[model samples]
Target: MVLFVIGIIACEKRLDEEVFSELAPSTLFTSEKGLSSVLNSSYAYAHRPGFQDSWAAYHLASMTTGEIWGQGGSIENLWLSEIDFTWDGNHDHIIAQWTIYFNSIRDANIVLDNLDNEEFSNEYKQLTEAEAHFLRGWDYSELYNLFGPVPLYKTSTDDPLLPRSSESEVQEFIEQELLAAIANLPVQAPAYGRASKGAAMAVLCKYYLNTKQWQNAADVAEDIQDLGVYELLPNYGNVFSIDNEGNNEILWALPKDATSPTASQAIDALVFPPDYPRPNPNNIVFAARTYLYDDFVNSFDENDTRRNYIITEYVSTTTGEIVPGLGDDRSFPYKIEFDPGAVGAAAGNDIPAIRYSDILLSRAEALNEISGPTQTAIDLINDVRTRAGISPLTLAGFTKETFREAILQERGWELFFEGKRREDMIRQDVFISNAVSRGKNAKDYHKLFPIPQVELDANPDLVQNPGY
Candidate 1:
């Protein structure tokens, strides 16, 4: 299996002449071990580093909103540019993310194409195929949201050039893939990190939300709640605690292990205060460059237990004195807390991509959209508020518009710094307006990021997203 793993790398590489010349799919997918290795490689792209420190999708999503700002330092301009909506197609972050998503899709396709290759048992083949479909759907979901209609590759191909699919076509493809994945995936994965029926349902719920399919979103979310396998953790803080990696609250998360390079999340090292204590000799300081915006800090009620995760001040390592964080420097998200015992950037804290709380919120939003304010919706919102130690909302004179606003705000407060802010803002149609209100020169065209210039250059069929 160890020797065959090299062939897995070739199978997962870019669909170009060099890779095709180097290795064929027959060489890698000839056995269960080989197919499994390539499938694992596909999952690796799920958490590409965004800038120098933060996860790319999470960082870009967080920075674009008014909730956060890049603390001034190295690559400060780059971060600020994204927040200001000034980044172009050539931005390295944009290019890197584009490659990650497409490469992930390609890798998933490789496994899907070879699933029937007679080298694997029926049980192993079904499970691996389900995992591949989920990965592909997940990657496409991210790519579709960020870059608009990207070239849809259903199978591995020798042709490097492809045209973009219509948004509707891509959406339908994602919907079908997720539906198929849901059928094959178990209600709960054998391990915390693997895909499951709940994960596929969660993704479908989000897709419905994104496409404004209100009733479908509501129904699917309700289906997830009815699964009876997930719930909100009693303590809000523990939800992100390293020890609570696979708590019931998490629907799907990227599993991290301190000793496994591929499994660890470096987010803690990137978010920890610059001078904070470290376990080893590495000067892995990326703290000051990313912090919560003052407005976001003030948005929280003092009694909200979730506020405990957002650090407003920290004691200096040099002076042993308390220092308050202010403005962009005032509040740092300590959500992924510093791990003094971690080796290098490897912090053993699983990053939740979808959680039960998120499903609850999305369901509430969809219900409100469908039938105004209903008790079921209010109860759903209240469930999350209660967990956050905040007073729950009542039905007293609640209009649909007001309830919608409240739910959106609730999501912002609950899911801050978790990489869903940008998507939330866009769904609520306030993404550009919020930036403009905060003095950013943002325009409507900034809603979707520019398709990377590198992609456009290599593929003649590609067009730069409008306003690039």
Candidate 2:
């Protein structure tokens, strides 16, 4: 599973468009208002309902880590491939994520291509281009995490039929693109959900961590801290609450519209069991359900406020009876709390794509990996621990190995259901073993999901991943 990292220190980091489909690129590129709408379209696709609900990170990745299970839906999802590790190219979640990444990239390219339009001022054009890069880089990371080196559609003109890029090319592209984005994005975003320096750098830090570029990862973490705009909010439970969407700790998020929220982003559809008493009587629980694996629920120290999201026992909505979580079966994920103003099941909670706490944890792990455990690493971890209402770990208690394991556990506790656990397990080299230990049929090759069968059929030049 070792990947070759090229001179990434030298190099630098898409989503949907609406009018893009209806109008010619030339026509759409003419006016400032027209161009702006195209850019907004990209955001819509990138931050669409599936982004938060159960696309890639939320289900496909988390399920592989043996942390959660999905059930009760006719619509296909990773739930189809959840427990057995039997998903193939046709897996619904796999195809959905693949489409999201490529389509997102396409839209970003559309925006970039139109940046030269004279209607917008030069400064506005530069900002627009940077925003395009940030989104394109974000989707690229999503694709790389799930599928390794996918076909590198660097821009819209890159042959649609081109085969996969070399791992190094893909890695370098991600780094260089993000570096460009970091250079252009402001320290503070002009508005909510917009990518900022912190968001772009957090992603670069993530790429560095996954590639095992320990020093680069640690360095980016420190750079984010230097921005002086981020900190862990005092309470873990409130971070994801619907009422606290754009709080200080959230570096960047996929925000829901206040007036007309997304229907598919109904995350509570999976979290609340049929009978769990929802604080909002108006919310609709969809057929889909997500239950925490009992072991994951039990792994947390009872004192960790983060554990508050795991609803183990609740008053039943219909029977007015108390229902206990079925061991290893039905503990719920209440991360995106019930949204009373919801369109149906969707919540107003802005799904956090990157957070301040992630920077601290990533830096701690990277430092430990680079030079073994250190006081700086310990303090970074303690920052998260303190916010979670848990006791801090002493430097004396951990060696490199133990610190690595502890940080991995801390990540699970603090960031589970936030779409980061798979990378954590993979970076820690336990992705497959954790599955096997839990009696799953995982293999080394299973670390990367197979390229979708439809993608292979449509683009003859594309090669499928090994063992698919």
Candidate 3:
């Protein structure tokens, strides 16, 4: 990780003097090489707080979404808050998520604020601006995904008492930032992990979809299709393979190092059973284990290639025999690609931020919302279904409502454990009801997480969500 001290207000509960340190007038900005030295910090900080970590990715994203939960593990107690829909401002993961996104946003702001230095060459300035805008937009979108509209800080701020923006206000901000990114971002990023025009457009689609702007969402998704730069890999498993980290299907992914602990993902520890043996010697098991709800795993069709990734049974390392993992130990979520060799749960699997399949699904749903079930929508859905080795749905299948239901289910199956579930259920208007159906005490206000308690206490100007 780059250790440059750029100007940023670290999004902690408390504001300290060091949080407002400046990046200007530094010798590091005198040359292009020096500017490049500090650029990785933006990507590193953004990627670190999301996909590479389990607290925000699995705990808040998947556990609350009704399909997945933890069983016997050290972190099971922590998982209960989200699993039961009892999370609040005081929840540890909620607080961490709020801090995480803002920290990443601050990183982007630091880079953006310094890009204008005359000492630095203008050759790379435009790319740097696009990258910063993309990261900021991505960070804000994720923040809006969890809490409705958080305290909006477009630039680095010494005053940490900014109030939360309105939902429409935040949405417009994301749209503007993404549009700017799309204008300058290259069709293909210079590097695998950098932001591209496709990434920006997909993110804009997400912003529109989440805001229920169907026309805008569908239009942006169509724009991505026109790019002709992305496609689904023939095999779903290989899409996430360490060997295919930046494959054609992926619009954006958080790059992970195979051997670096801080630079890799911990999915194996959170989802795999401790005693289960892995095929590769490098993929060692960790103690943390999350269970696949029996109902959800059973919901998958037997022919689904996607279901094969969810291990219902596994060979126990200690016993040297196949064990009933489904109702016994725990069915593991093996969706995130595991590295053949790495330390503990930190594997080289680059976490996907968005895939071409997501764009296809988004366009289909948006079209469905705009009109009724159209042939175009069905064809788009089939593209994803064909890759999954499942039977395609014809136009004669059903009415508008049924198609919507099918789209939601397809997304649940295809995007499982990729940090999209929580938002998916909410957008489908089933997040709270789905939990209530499963005996959780979900309330209307539970749709959005509360602002972190520390932030509220620190800034009285910040208003909390409807319910505490």
For each candidate in turn, the TM-score is: 0.91, 0.92, 0.91
lDDT against the true structure, each candidate: 0.77, 0.77, 0.77
lDDT (C-alpha) at residue 362 in model 2: 94
Candidate 2: stretches off by over 4 Å: 1-27, 50-56, 75-80, 258-264, 326-328
Model 1 shows how many backbone clashes?
Answer: 4
* 113-228: candidate 2 lDDT, tens digit per residue: 87776567988887878878888888888899999998877676777899899999999889888988999898877556667888899989998999999999999999999988
- Candidate 1 ranges with C-alpha deviation above 4 Å: 1-27, 49-54, 260-263, 277-283, 326-329
* Candidate 1, residue 5: how far the Cα is off, in Å: 7.3
Instruction: Give the poorly placed runs of model 3, Cα more than 4 Å off.
Output: 1-25, 29-31, 49-55, 280-282, 327-329
Least lDDT summed over 10 consecutive residues: which range in candidate 2? 4-13
Superior by TM-score: candidate 2 or candidate 3: 2
**Tens digit per residue, CA lDDT, model 3, 13-68:** 21111211244445554455444444555665566533335346666888887767
Q: What is the lDDT of candidate 1?
A: 0.77
Q: How displaced is residue 461 in candidate 3, in Å?
A: 1.8
